[model samples]
Target chain A: MRSPTEAAAGADDLAAMFGRHARELLRYCTRRVGPQLAEDVVAETFLVAHERRHRFDPSRGELLPWLYGIATRLLRRHVREEVRALKQVPHVPDAGYDDAAAHRVDAQRDVARLSAVLAKLPRRQRDVLMLYAVAELEYAEIAAALEIPLGSVQSSLHRARAKVKAAMSEEDNR
Target chain B: MSRTDPDLIAVRELPPGLAEPSDEAVARVWHKIAARPAPRRSSRRLWVPITAAAAVLALVGAGIFFLRPRTVSQPAFTTDRETVTRVIGDLRDRAVTAEPVSVGPGQVIYQTIHVV
Candidate 1:
């Protein structure tokens, strides 16, 4: 049994962690699954972190990747929802007539194409790609987050990016 | 390794109205994290058996206190000579003053005696 003081200290540490990382993590989840499910994913991530706080080793890596890893694992349960949301992106109406609006429409089109490609990616590759592109973690951090070899992270990211590029080029051709 | 790739940019750009999490959402999640049950340490686990053993010992002690053989204290009349003498005197006076009955020819008499 942890002393009351030790447990309090652990809670404080987790609260501090949440204060720092919750927003970024929320944004990341929102991108993977829409805003509706993002909050749930973020909440679960922190709860899992609190449950497994004893297993955390600061010497291994920073805390963000660890949290991302937990969120990523939890996201597996919603893979179908996420892919469906991605595939639906292109169909959403784009409404505006201003220059900024035109730019946004073009961006949305590009994003829609990327989302389609992302939906079809293998789980590991998509995870690596999202972590790289959205969370902006370093290769080492991605490795730590996913608990995979550094070389594996590198290769997965490479393959994921290449696939996105190829898909985008094919869209351009059409 | 340029982050400027259009596809990467597209991935980074969130859909309309999807930005940083609202304060309410963050607070809701933080509440959950804060409200989580604290992890029990090994020492805490030891309390269960320790408490149970203490309760068992207490029950055993209570059982011994209640069920053990006891020495009966002597009654006051037996312990005090004056009380015993007084009681005997009263019994004798009552017997001396008791009414006598005529016996029928076929009837048998039954008497109860108290030995001091």
Candidate 2:
């Protein structure tokens, strides 16, 4: 059992950690699972991190990747929901004859198409791709986040990018 | 890292709405985290169930050990004074009427008796 002082200190640490990384973590989760489920994922991520804090080896990598790793694991439980959400990315209707509206429509179509492609990707490849493109983590950070080898990360990302490129080109040719 | 890659551009252009989570959403998450119970001492939590399980197992084992049926080695037939007397009388009668038997080098006699 933790003493009162210890509990208070742990709470303070959690608060500090939340303040430091919650926003970005939330954004990353939102991209993967939409805002509706992202909040829960974020909360659960922190709770898991707090519970497993003792197991975290500081020598391995930065705390952000660890948080991401935790979030990614939690996200696995909601993969079906995520894929459904991605496949259902709403298409914005053409509302006007202006260039801005035209651009918005084109962008929306691209997002919808890309989301469909993402939904169809294999889970590991999608994870690697999202960690690279959405979370914007480097190869080393991605490897740490997924607990995969650096070579696996590179290969998975390469395959993901190739697939995405092929898909986008197919969409263009259509 | 190529800026001209259409795939990268499309991925980067997902939507502005997903760029940041609302402040209220963040607060709700913070509130949930703050409201969660403190992490239980794992050893303390685990010891209780483990001890309980061991005790139940011990009790079950004791019940089986004490309640199970037992086997005893006994004679095939019941023995009584009357039966023993009758057997002895018959053996004496047979000896009186029997012819004398010759003894051999490797031959031996075996006998069984029931005692009460």
Candidate 3:
């Protein structure tokens, strides 16, 4: 797997760079905007990363966070679609099921419930939350990736988690 | 009994229905990547910003040079710092040794009051 630094040095190395980060970035994008538009988002992200490769400094941070930041900016353009997609409740009718199948449905219901709650969060909070939850970035990484203060990351994550927890309990009650 | 935080629970429990990037997309990016210059060092036109900034600094420096008030430098009273120090020392001795006249025989002062 090529580091972004290597990719930045030469365009040919981008394939190597993409080979490294693309899978995770794709999953992140997919979770945000669903599968259909995820590739478009990732394509636009790498292209932008290529153009702005000059700005990346390995000493300051890693390329993954920088790529996330770039991918996120592109995702912002599709905020409406993302919100709509995330809010979609998979139309799985509840039927008498084996224990494992019932557990799967419950999990899917939780995911759907979380999605609706996530859409209602403030844009800034939602970005912080989704990046943390979906991308699996640490607080420090998320801070660097978002160019926000570590304190802000903590606060935003706190708020986001609280909202998700509250929404989950509400769903459980229903 | 539940020690897990909501976020951790969400991560472990909520599986992502993630979409993989299409092979066509990968190939498209691959071709785009191939079309790029394969040089090891990323090319940055360093001279452009550096030269522009240097020019701006030069212009500002020149502007200050032309616009600021000029000081009139005077010829030194002594040729060197040693000469100036010697002169000051001599003047101090002469000042301290000279006695003031007692107008009424009441006191004799070692230094003159008016000159220094």
**Proportion of native contacts kept per candidate:** 0.65, 0.73, 0.23
What's the residue-level lDDT of A94 in candidate 1?
65
lDDT of 1 by residue, A14-121 (tens): 677677789989889988897778888888888778778777666667777889999999999999999998888756356477988877776677778787888999
Candidate 2, residue A157: CA error in Å? 0.6
State which candidate has the highest DockQ. Answer: 2
Tens digits of per-residue lDDT, candidate 2, B1-116, equal: 76447786676556445556788989998988888887666797899999999999999999999999999877577478899999999999999999987779999867789774
Across all models, the iRMS values in order are 2.2, 2.2, 4.8
- Report the first chain's TM-score for all candidates: 0.83, 0.83, 0.83
lDDT, candidate 3, A1-174, per-residue tens: 456566456433556668888878877887777665777778777777777777877655678888998888899999999788767768656844698888788777778887778888887788888787777777887888888999999899888788888888886896
Off by over 4 Å in 2: A1-12, A90-105, B2-5, B41-116
What lDDT tens digits, residue by residue, belong to model 3 across residues B1-116? 13256655574334364335566766665555556554443345776788899999999999999999998887655578898899899999998999955466765557657732
TM-score for candidate 3, residues paired by index: 0.60
* Residue B106, candidate 2: C-alpha displacement in angstroms: 22
DockQ of each: 0.33, 0.43, 0.12
lDDT pick, better of 2 and 3: 2
